[model samples]
Target: MQTRALRTGGFDLLVSGLLAACLLTLCGCTSDRAIAKKEKATHVVPVKTVAVETTQVQRSTLQPATVHAFYRAEIRAKASGFVKNLQADIGDYVEAGAKLAEIDVPEMLMQRQVIDKRIERLIAEEQRGQAGVRLAEARVRSAQALLAEASSQMAGAEASLAASQAEFDRTEDLVERGSLQNRMLDESRMKRDSEAARRDAMASSIESAKAEVAVAEAQVVAAQAASDAAQAETEIERSQRQEMDALLDYATLRAPFAGVVTQRNLEPGDLVRQSNEVGRGQPLFVISQVDRVRVRIAVPEAEAALVNPGDEVTLTFPSFSAAQPIVAAVTRTSGSLDPSTRTMLVEVELDNQDGKLLPGMFGQASIHLDSKVAAQTLPSRAIRFDEEGNGYVYVVGEDETIARADITTGLDDGNSIEVLSGIEPGQRVVGPHLKRFSDGQKVAVLPN
Candidate 1:
């Protein structure tokens, strides 16, 4: 009976041990399967992508500018004097040759009066000299008449002397023959001698008359010289008077063109002087041609090559809030870069017929450059840098796994970069997963 009971207990213990071993094996297999599934799901990386498109890109440059007049002028006082009246004020429109201001020149007027008086005196002197010349001519004629009378008297006296001499000769012959008395012959001879003396006196008188005529001729010459001198003096005085009159006219200022008086420096009764300082040419009043305006800008040396004359440009002025942008064309350039600022000067012209724009206004300009070839551009954030300082991106492979790609870059326009190589259009790239990426990493793509 004791042997049979011990065998039954040993059999039951063996059965319990076998069942526990089988259960342990089954639980180990199930845990290994669960771990494999978790590892496969967690190791795969999901990435975002962008589509590449071919489009035209414009190269542009922006710069600050200033508005100016096409032609500006500064009006100054040409003649010095006291301002008498002001005809135009600031912001007044004036035509060419219009009166601007008038000056009081009392000294000039007095000078003209003096010149006139001198001319009158010279004329009076000339007339007096002419009268003297006429008087001298009359005296010469009177002297000539007296000389003719003296000549006639001398001829008569000579005839009488000849007759008396003939008689004396005959009387002397008779006395020799005792036909006449000696007293009679002496009387005849006395008569002849007296007539001869009378003829000599008349001849002397004629000579004196000729001398008087010569004196009269000299007087006429002197009078003519005086008249010529007086005429010359009158001409000189007349010329002086004309010059003073011209100076008086210069005292009145006039506008040189049709434009608005943008500035006023002096008023009535103000004293203005001419400017002679270097670089400060003049400072009386400012004038500008408001029919057209100009804008000047300085472009940097790196971008100056892209601008050209006649190109369209836009200008904006801060002074006008509701004013539309002024459209203009590039008129000219400075042609050389400035060494100090490394910029080139540019000018644009615009119409301002309404006088809305003024000189010295601040503005800005935008210049369009040449168009570039169609290229694939990516966002700047898509690019990545490695430890070796090489730029690259993560490209999605056919099996949807991540692979590191090396790329060459071109121009960067602040928002996007031109991809030169190492990537094709339509290829999926990792979107900024720079910190959590590795070579040949498994990835899951995100929907667009």
Candidate 2:
């Protein structure tokens, strides 16, 4: 009976051992299946994605700038003299062409008086010369009349001499033919000789008249020359007076344009020198037009080409911080870069009718460098850089597989990056946790 009992107990024990071993194997299989399931789930990463779409992209730059007056000028003395009647000082508004001050040019004034006297005396001389010319012309007419009378007298003398000769010839012929008395013939010859003497005396008188006419003509010429000389002298004196008048006009300083005086360096009774002289002296005044202002900016070379006239700009002045930023369009550009600083000059004009904006003020300028109207873009996080600095994105295909796509990018606005190439609209790209995915890896899209 003892042997039978031992055999049953051993079988029970073996059965218990077999059950424990089966339970252990079952637990081990369950643990292995759980781990495998977790590994499988990890391979199919759940990623957030975004669709590539078109949007507006902009890029801008900020640069320091300065404010200046629209028009400024330095007023200086044009004539050397003592300052007198100084009518303008600093902070005075003046009109264009208004007299600002008068220069006390005592010597110049005295010289002007002398010039006036000289001009008056020359006028009298010119009148005297005119009278002399009239006298000379009258003498010429008298000389001409005398010449005519002398010619008439000469003709009459010739005719009478001819008549006397004819009578003598007739008497001598009659005497030779013994038809007349000798005494009559002799008397006729004597009469002819007397007529010849009279003719000679008349000729001498005519020559004397011609000589008088010539002398009168010579005197007339001399008088006319003297008259012309007097007239020339008068004209020269008048020209000198005119030059003096112009110099006198320069003695008074006038405003070149309508503006406010921003500086004053001279006072009444101060000696002023000509501004154009060697070693130019200090300016007497500074004029500026404050109804309008200009903001000047120096854009760097790299972005100079992007700036253009008429582009919108925003300006902020440090002195007027509480004031709103001023919006204006670019007024002008230098078109070329400065060689020394590699910068381009740009300016914007604004109306300052209120006189709030002052010259030499500091400010900031925000300039739009580039803009895109319908650019393909994605979230900035969706783009990544390679070791070579090239940008890329993980694009999800229709099969839900991620394919690394290399891309070219343009303007970035912090939130979105413009895709210049390699990606099209409607394409889905991985947005975040990009490091977990690789090329050709499967992924599950999560709602974003």
Best by lDDT: 2
lDDT per residue for candidate 1 within 40-74, as digits (tens), equals 65677667876544555545566898878777777
**How do the predictions measure up, each by TM-score?**
0.52, 0.67
Using TM-score as the measure, the top candidate is: 2
Off by over 4 Å in 2: 1-53, 57-65, 172-176, 182-221, 277-279, 299-316, 319-337, 347-349, 364-372, 377-448
> Tens digits of per-residue lDDT for model 2 on 98-178?
788889888878887887787788778767777777776777677677767767766777787788889889988999999
Clashing residue pairs in candidate 1 are 45-443, 45-444
Clashes of each: 2, 0
Global Cα lDDT for candidate 2: 0.84
